[model samples]
Target: MNAALKQIDAWQTSLAPTLPTLPGNDIDWLAQRRSEALTQFSDIGFPTRKTEAWKYVATHAIAKTTPALSQSTIVDSTQIAQWRLDDCDEIVFVDGLYHEGLSHFTANANIDIKSLAESFEHSPDKIKALLSQDISDANDAFDALNQALLRDGAIVTIADGAVVERPLHLLFVSTNTDNSVTPINNWIFAGKNSQCNIVETYIGADTTNNLTLSRTTINVADNAELTHYRSQRESKQAFHLAELTVKQNRDSRYNAYPIALGSAIARVNVEIILAGKNANCTVNGLYLTKDKQVSDHHIKMYHAVPHCTSDQLFKGVMDDSSRAVFNGLILVDKDAQKTQADLSNRNLLVSKFADINTKPELEIYADDVKCSHGATIGQLNEQSIFYLQSRGVARDQAEHLLTYAFINDVINRIQLDALRKQIAALIIGRLPDSEFIRELV
Candidate 1:
């Protein structure tokens, strides 16, 4: 067997003893689903460099370590406060398990929030319908693994015609003292004509080496709108893999912003389906990696119906020996006439050792559709840096300003004011001339 297959074998052996005790495993259907997922994962194993989609980054380091389940530990209030979004309803999960103590929410007639475990126990039928729906999960190893080991997460449902003004925050925190892995599954169901905003944040304590595998499913009914934002700031020793699957109905709108700031290896796979006519989807993402970290993003936007629109913009800033990968695909079916799609991936490298690989692809079967895709990888403009330096700015500060300006476009797209500022601060702090940037901003 290959190394990837061996790793899968080891993981299966180590995970077998804990399977019976896993939450929701007692349910026959859920158990059978988990088994099927495990078998699928075993067949594919981890995606290695040989895999076309995963060619740029290696997964050997992650495969070498076997992951155990994470346990709850004491988390400081300061750490929690740092991640809290102002004026938002919060659902806190520590080590992939929902924590009642740290979570805060109220009973709203128009909105309902419940833990995934509770939903599975109380409304198995509803949960099953949502769980059974898949958007390319079987084709991905990490997503299948997440399905097999999924434990707890938050599920939010917005009532029809109701508008939620405040954003709902789902915070996933890892405080693992040892090498472990946590798999979380979240669902969002937006009813017809309803509107809501969701913010999912992934963070970890210092020097955490845990692995987090997350899967999110979103369903938007006709005329509904969903603004989704996800940010990941984990320790450099940690690994993160997340898959987002979304299906939008007729006349619905969905906007997504994914930001990656920290992690040794971070990958996010986003799949969106415009399943109904006049549906619109937009995705804007930014990833900043320093040291030896690797950040990868793969996005697939499908215009499944006529008169649908989709747009995507992804940018990355890499320093030190870090590497980043961006692969985006826009597919328009033969019958999807009048479809409009655009995709752009741009990267900036700060060091000679840093690297980036980006590919933007479009597959259109309808000649009436308008689809455009492009990819760019380059350094800062020398003329722009010279102009800043000539204006009395220090050389280091000039370079920092140019780099910050490159990513500021994506930052400005964040709808939440507090989140936008917090993300800006985090990005500024990572630069070499943070003090100067802070003083200027």
Candidate 2:
């Protein structure tokens, strides 16, 4: 058999025995869905270079590793203390399993929160309804595999016309270094006219060589507003793959900020559908990579109705032999008139050997729509660095300053003060003379 086939066989042989232990396995409907997903995954396996959406990046490393499903690891609160954000309600997941002892959040009347396992036990009907929804338009092998090995994740629901005063933090940590894979599925629903902020963070121990597959689905009701932030800081020896899907109703608003800073091979796919008129969304993202790491971001904005607007801005900074890819598309339906959409991707190659591949696309069937897309990949201007050096700044420090400035635009868009500061500190720490630059910022 070929390498791809071998990988598929290995995965099926290893995971088949554990199917009975998965959450909701006992539910006939859920079990049937899982079985179908597993069959689909077995048939397609992982995507190869021929797959247009995954053409720019290779998945050979993941196939070769073929990490098994992750098992729960004992993690103490102090072990993840540094990752906790202030003034936020936190939910912690270790190795894809919810850890109630490590998670602390206050109960509020306007919002209801539960783990996927809890929902399976107490709210199986709701879970069945969500899992049975149609996602054929964007479903892939990775998504199927996540469902096949479904585990625990957060489920958030905001009451209609209510406002959540504090941000909700969903933190996932990986401490297993035995070549394991963790699958997480999160659901968030913003009721009509409701407002809330959510943050999803993925982190790992330094020596990990694990893999994480996470999927989050969100729905914003009429006139609702949601601010979502995602941060990926897994171990440099690990692999991370994630997907985010959002659907908006009339006059709903969505603001997204995604930052990628770690993982040996990391890929994130984001899709937003404007299902109702007058929906608006803005996405700003940044990816910083060094050494031999790889990062990829794929985004799609679908304008299905009239009078919707979308704006996307993504930036990347690559150093050493690191590589990054950005693929963004804005699609407007034939009847979606008066749509205004724009996409921009800018990348900086900090080292001669660093590389970046960016593609910004627009497909509009509407005649009266306004749409634009562009991409730029280049190195920092030597003249700008020369000017900084002439101003008494060292060469290395000048480069660090310019690099930091390149990603600060996206960082500045984060509205959460505490989270913004924490992200800033993390970014600065990655550059040379971080202590010196910290004083300037």
Best by TM-score: 2
Q: Ten residues in a row with the worst lDDT in model 1?
A: 129-138
Clashing pairs in 1: none
What TM-score does model 1 achieve against the real structure?
0.97
339-379 per-residue lDDT for model 2 (tens digits): 99999999999999999988888998999999999999888
Cα RMSD (angstroms) for every candidate in the order listed = 1.4, 1.1
lDDT of each: 0.88, 0.90
TM-score of 2: 0.98
List model 1 lDDT by residue over 1-441, tens digit each. Answer: 876677899988877666667777889999888888878888888887788878998988888888877767877667789889899989999989998888888889889999987877898898887776665547778788888887788888999998999899999999985878888988899999999999999998777888899988899999999999999998899999988889999999999999988789999988899999999998899999899999999898989899999988999999999999988999899989999999989899999999998888899998898889999999999999899889999888999988998988899889899899999988988887888887875
Misplaced by over 4 Å in model 1 are 1-3
Model 2: pairs clashing at backbone N, Cα or C within 3 Å: none
